[model samples]
Target: MITLRDVVLRRGVKVLLDGATLTINPGEKVGLVGRNGAGKSSLFRLLDGTLHEDKGEFQVPAHWRMAQVAQDMPETDQSATRFVVEGDVTLLAAEREVAEAEASDDGERMAHAYMALNDAGAHDANARAQALILGLGFRLDELERPVNSFSGGWRMRLQLARALMCPSELLLLDEPTNHLDLDALVWLEAWLQRYPGTLLVISHDREFLDAVTQVTVHIEHAQLKRYGGNYSRFEDMRAEQMALQQAAFARQQDKIAHLQKFIDRFKAKASKAKQAQSRVKALERMERIAPVLAEADFTFEFAEPANLPNPMLVLQDVDFGYPGEDGAGPATIVRGVNRSVLAGQRIGILGANGQGKSTVVKTIARTLAPLAGTVTEGKGLNIGYFAQQELDVLSPRDNPLEHMIRLVKETTAQGRLSGQPTREQDLRSFLGTFNFTGDQVFQAVGSMSGGEKARLVLCMIVWQRPNLLLLDEPTNHLDLATREALSVALNEFEGTVMLVSHDRSLLRAVCDEFWLVSRGGIAPFDGDLDDYQRYLLDMAKQAREAQREQARAAEPPAPAPVVDRQAEAQRQKQRNEQLRPLKKELAQIEQRMAKLGDERAQLEAQLMQATQDPARLAEAGRRLKAVESELATVEARWLELSEAIEQAGA
Candidate 1:
């Protein structure tokens, strides 16, 4: 168990926790949540030993090993797999011991070292590391890529994988889902649910907290409050408690008013003067109930657009991707994407991490031109695009006010400003609606927290009064309160919305339909997010099995044992006879899979063409589902047969 009793923690002169006490039992998964700048990360630092309590007792079991994602960017050229494998400290130590024992030529020491290495799982370290990598959305080919070759966000994912690779009794994760896509986030949630250790994570992702946490710890007003059950349960209980508290406070206020009235009426009368004095004493001695003061929640809404353009944008067989480098042809990530963004439609873009969700959004936003074909926009169409790398577009040296001022000037220069405010004061007033007020609005944007920057971006978007919103991972930096507020605002907005986000709660709250961008094409997803999650899990399982098979194939073959030629020939003949039926079945499954694949592609094309015809769309969707189900069944059997044949040959 970990205990913090009467703990007082400080950052410089400001006290974050005062007389705060909390006890987390061993193997419990706890979520630590608080408002931005409310010491959640600071408390994490305290638990991770980077900081200590300023004036109280804090204790954890001395023997418990801790693991946390490194905050620093890795500069190593080591291959991704090797870098993650090295995070297994126990395995590394055991291997070092084995090397030393061999060098010393000590037989007993060598034997013990070998045992330790095996215990540490040295043989499967690469496999385990690769599993973590793949589950976090890395491709198989990236396993041997240099760590430095990945972007900052990808490197951070590798950092998370490294932390998970370490053997630990206590794990600390802060915002683990910020860099993950929906599929990767789902995989991570499943992984965390199976972790056999104490987890203390700080996250603004409500669904993630509800999924992985068994306990909730809230920090507010310099106190730590513990609650049983997950985040949803805690929210329900907390709201109920607040309601009861408010009722009590209202009753107390009435009693105090009655007492005060009585004292005022009798104080000047001699007969009741002593009674008045007694009343004063009673008032002084009373334990008054304080009124519940609600926290200042940030909320904003998009101004209704000047006009709604039906079919806001149309993609006609567009090849959505980036232009190739070095004079090469353009790279098409998602091809033949034919879709229309209709007014008042709420669409969620769904796909695996690298399957072109962002690319589709980017193409629609005109950040990337179509490699081929046309993107037609309706007349008077206005778009508000929140890119995944939105923060990078903001000038670091400028403040929120400056950013808004620049936006106004740019829009005016482009002659797109309709009835929007252009004055500096009007812009500042608008910034205040997003909680960027006073000196904060003038503060450098570079020094602001991620949440603040995200809010600024939203503020700018709202100012534009766009008829169509293209938001990509907009909630990645937003806290729970802000996300809920965003959901409400989005629902109220009278415009088309196309969103790409990993936050399931937001997705469920905002999206009405889903489009799956996959296998170099786009199609309407007939199922909901739950079905998508199951599909991702199934895909992850297949990937892991494939990786294991590849590892087995890469291993050096064992030396052949001495045997009689006649006996070997007899065994070989028996193996060949056994494999004949299996091979035939395997070949048949392959042919069926190929046929099903072709049918699926044809059905998808039909579905795309039939979007406007309800009858044709329904029929195509039904056939596609059937084809997909049969393909899955056939593929599973094919894999089984292949594995069996490989074992028999061995």
Candidate 2:
């Protein structure tokens, strides 16, 4: 357990926490959430002993082992598997001890060293590391590749895998999903669900928090407030708290108003002079209640299209991919493509990494011309395309105002500018919508943070007033507030939107339907996010099985070694005894889960049809939520029991 009482933490002159206190119990999963600069990361630093409190008590058990993702990128030439396996320092050390003891011909020491190695699971630690890598979307062949050959984002994933590989009692992850795709993110959630540790994570992703956290700690106004349950529950409780606070404040204001009115009316009268004085004293004695601070409002709208088109764009027999090197030909990524994006349609592009999600987005944006087919667009079509790579769309030397100004000049030259000529001040005022103010607007793009750059790109996109927006991972670096702002803007926009993002909350909020990019083809994905998650898990399992089959096929046949049948039989009997209870529990949980899943699906169907009456819809929604939660819990338990059974058999 960790405890902090009246902790005061500061950096330079900025006081992050003022008398903030909180307790975190063992084996609890906690979400530390706040605004971008609200000291969430700083709190992690304090916990890891990189920072010290200026006042108050902060305590953690000295014997607790901690694990966190490394901030620094690895520039090593080591194999990726080896790099990840080394994250378990204790296991590696024990293995080294056995090797050294054998070399020294110390039989007694060698025996002790072997026992330590077995206790640390040294033999299978590499397998565990590889599993983590696979779960994080790494290919089997890439496991033995040099770590330095991977890109920066992938190296960060390697860091995450390393952190997970480490054996620890306390785990701290800061935005672990930043580099992951939706598939990998789903896999991570399941992995974290089974983690038997005291977990504290800092994440801006609301859905991730809701799925993994049992408690949410919010830092606001230099104070820490703890809420029970997940992020959604926290929001509900916080909204109620604020509402009551505001109501009490309104009542206090009304009482003060009546008292002041009486005093003002009677202060000049002779008989009522004493009463007025009493009223004045009473007013002085009254304590003022602070008004509840409402959440910051973010409202913006995309401009109406210059001309409405029934179908914004159409792709017929399109073979979309990158142009081949040296003017050979375009390499087909996904073939036999046929899609018609209609006006006011919201589509989500879904696929695993390197599976053509972005390729499809680029083809729609017309940045990459179709190899073998035509892409037809409506008359006077305007597009607001946001590339996944922020730097690709933004100039390093240009400022936000310059980007907007350049946009105006380019559009005006192309005869795409509407209404009247725009001025520099207009661009500056528009940039303020994204929280850029004063001298910040004049700063170079290279100096800006990732979030700031993302905002600037979005500002430019919205300013174009396009009828269609092709946004690829727009919320990658955005905070929760900005994400909400974007969602609201997209909801209100009278245009089409195509999104490819790992942020499930944003995807669920904005996308009306989904198109899956898989196996070099595009098709409609019929189910929702939950079904997609199951699909990803099944795909991973299939991949693992295929790899095992491939390895077996490649190996040369060998004669079996002589076995001790009696000992094996005894071992099998012991394994069965150990696994009996777990197998029974797994079967029961699976049965319950199937029933709950059916219940949820039925309730969801009812919800869709019950919207004519608000009461029916609300009740159906409530039942669906409970059934889904129960299903998730049971599924996690099944994973636990299955893993236990497998380990015991091993």
lDDT for each candidate structure? 0.91, 0.90
Q: Cα miss at 34, model 1 (Å)? A: 1.1
lDDT of 1 by residue, 1-650 (tens): 99999999999988999999999999999999988888999998999889999888999899999999999999999999999999999999998999999999999899789879999998899989988999899998999999999999999999999999999999999999999998889989999999999999999898899999999999998999999989999999899999999999999888889989999999999999999999899899999887898998888899989999788888898888899899998888988878888989999999988999988888788888899888999888999988888665588899999998899888889889957778888888888889987899899988988888889999889989999999999988999999999999999999999999998898999999999988899999999889989988888788788877997999999999988999999999999999999999999999999999999998888877844689878988898998899899999899789979998999
> Mind giving the per-residue lDDT tens digits that candidate 2 earns over 78-177?
9999999999978989989998999999988997898799999977887899999988999989999999999999999999999998899999999999
Per lDDT, the best of the predicted structures is 1
Name the weakest run of 10 consecutive residues (lDDT summed) in model 1. 604-613
- Model 1 per-residue lDDT at 46: 95
The local lDDT score (0 to 100) that residue 157 gets in candidate 2 is 98
Query: Could you estimate the TM-score for every candidate?
Result: 0.84, 0.83
Q: What's the lDDT of the predicted structure labeled candidate 2?
A: 0.90
